[model samples]
Target: MTTTISYEQAKAYYEQWGVNVDLALKQLNQIPISIHCWQGDDISGFETIKSELSGGIDVTGNYPGKARNGDELRSDLEKALSLIPGKHRVNLHAIYAETNGQFVDRDEILPEHFAKWVDWAKQNGLGLDFNPTLFSHEKANDGLTLSHPDEHIRQFWIDHCIASRKIGEYFGKELGTPCLTNIWIPDGYKDIPSDRLTPRVRLKESLDTIFEYKTDEKYNIDAVESKLFGLGSESYVVGSHEFYLSYAQQNNKLCLLDTGHFHPTETISNKISTMLLFNEKVALHVSRPVRWDSDHVVILDDELKEIALEIVRNNAIERVLIGLDFFDASINRIAAWIIGTRNMIKALLYALLIPHNYLKELQEQGNFTERLALIEEFKTYPFGAIWDHYCEISNVPIREKWLQEVQIYEKDILSKR
Candidate 1:
């Protein structure tokens, strides 16, 4: 009837596999997943000057309780964090800058615009991450930025990314944790491109100029994200995974792999070990893809478990930076955040409880049959019991109980919006 008693019983089962359940829970508590802020408002940031959601991405459903402003967004995020059993980071985009309703273009925006966010982060005891908004702007209306043929347009995005790095540095300095400022551009062609090399060259040059104005690594870390294709850019995307992978390796930067950005057949879980072998660190945007890069809410699917297993087995827990990236306006926004984030944490916990060493040894000894059988058997292990104990100990609601709190919040706080 009690969680402690159930957890003790579960511990014994894992102990038979030479697994340390207590250590697994301790490691799970120490790991922090970065929760994306865009989910709170359906990627509709509070920018004074707005543009249509373009650049090969779109958010559907008119969910009525979307946070309309910075304060409301943070309030909703606070509610979500209260339910998730960990101290996590918040991922922000440049378009979320607050300038008191003043029209501040992307390139001209400064660190001061995000001072409120930094202060709020400090108050909440959370780390912050950032992204440069390269789509949905006049400069990118032609679906080109950082790789545009026009010198003026290309330079504008370069300036914006440079400013974004400075803001990231400010956050890292103020918060005592390095801020990951990731760059994801939407420069591609809907159809076949007459010239692919030229655009990639321009993108490389623009990035060179942006990285030239560098900040201290202690305060800021830079990463580049690549995509297979997007809505408008069906046939060609300039920053393919190969392009950014090579760039990150040569430039000494982190490569951010978005789970949904790769082809349907491609799996980020398989890529993690290879990435860790080459790069000092790797970053992730954990999202689910329905058909294409749909950015669906993450679930405890097989791929999620594989991704977590890769990280834990390789002892790359500190080397991999995990962040959630999904936006669904069909349901309560806060509930979306809670579900996606909690699932991510659950995947990590599940991985932590596995006996990876024994599995590897079995493979090394050419015992494939045993490896497969043991892995499958472990799937039926009482993972839920350990997780419920974690939630109970973390002072968060257990299992579906959090849903009741979300419903109450929706009725009292979200419905009025």
Candidate 2:
């Protein structure tokens, strides 16, 4: 645990640099990061017959204690939320429908399938974000949806997307917060295809159909996500970043940028400023990518800092919707959740404590030399002390102390399962 005197001294040190630790904590508390539900169960929802993990989605570990049902998933989420400091929202995919033993296909899914989730979120005082499960279905056997050649198959996915939005609206109305219903379809091909334009045209038309219904944005907001490539769709992905960027701009909808969905060399931080410049709202799916779209646990690395810095420095924190989209079944699920969520909060707080305007002034005046020096200097500016203080204020365990709780939970709760 961080000592009180040490934290106070660190606060005093930052105070000399004109960074308000109190203000940083207040800003960090206000941001609600949506935690993805798929993390608890490796994207395996409570279906009587399990669906094959297809559509460019695959989890590579046989880690024990994976949630077997909706009840277990919710219980795991509760454990995770207890360890994480701030109140956050829960992100759910349509596949996580609690159908109560009755099998519900993707297209035929209704709001009632998610009634239990809504109630759970309501009771927990956490907002809900939804995503249409466009993968891992019989209809997605060809690794294409919405952009599929057959009209019947495309219509089936369109109906599923429509149903998902309605469910999102229901969740929003019930929870009294606008549910962000994000659509991400893994429609692509492995080998090179001759006619790429036709699939894209089909995809555009299908998206148009999905957005035809005018659901009140107050209840539910729509966001379309893009992918550069995937496990199977390596050669060509239909919903490329360019496609969704253009679609989002033309249709006045929010664009979702998943950190793991882009090229390994390209970070999502660079796009934050550009997206906020063009759109009224932008959404994010924060995940660590290991060479490919391998959903690794998020760490407090330079990419995460850059991402948080862009949002905080540009004054677009409120306009940007932050959500974690990681699925690592290799470790304890609860620990993974706590670690990622805490790291995300820490990154945001680190960004909040920075004197961005002061640095921007140096850049604007063409003082690059001093700007570079101060950038390195600010990195060592008592962030750890401020972080411990923030954790103390938030009433969660400080640093590795949280891990002890996770270990206890694993022994008592997870081991029993």
Instruction: Give the winner by lDDT.
Output: 1
For candidate 2, write residues 370-405 as lDDT tens digits: 899988987888788778877787788887888898
**Cα error of candidate 2 at position 110, Å:** 1.1
Model 2, stretches more than 4 Å misplaced? none
Residues 319-375, candidate 1, lDDT per residue (tens digit)?
999999999999888999999999999999999999999999999999999999999
Q: What's the true lDDT of residue 300 in model 1?
A: 96
Candidate 1: stretches off by over 4 Å: none
Cα error of candidate 2 at position 74, Å = 0.8
Screening candidate 1 with a backbone cut-off below 3 angstroms (N, C-alpha, C), the clashing residue pairs are: none
TM-score of each: 0.99, 0.98
Clashes per candidate (backbone, < 3 Å): 0, 0
Query: After TM-score superposition, what is the CA distance of residue 357 in candidate 2 from its true location, in Å?
Result: 0.8
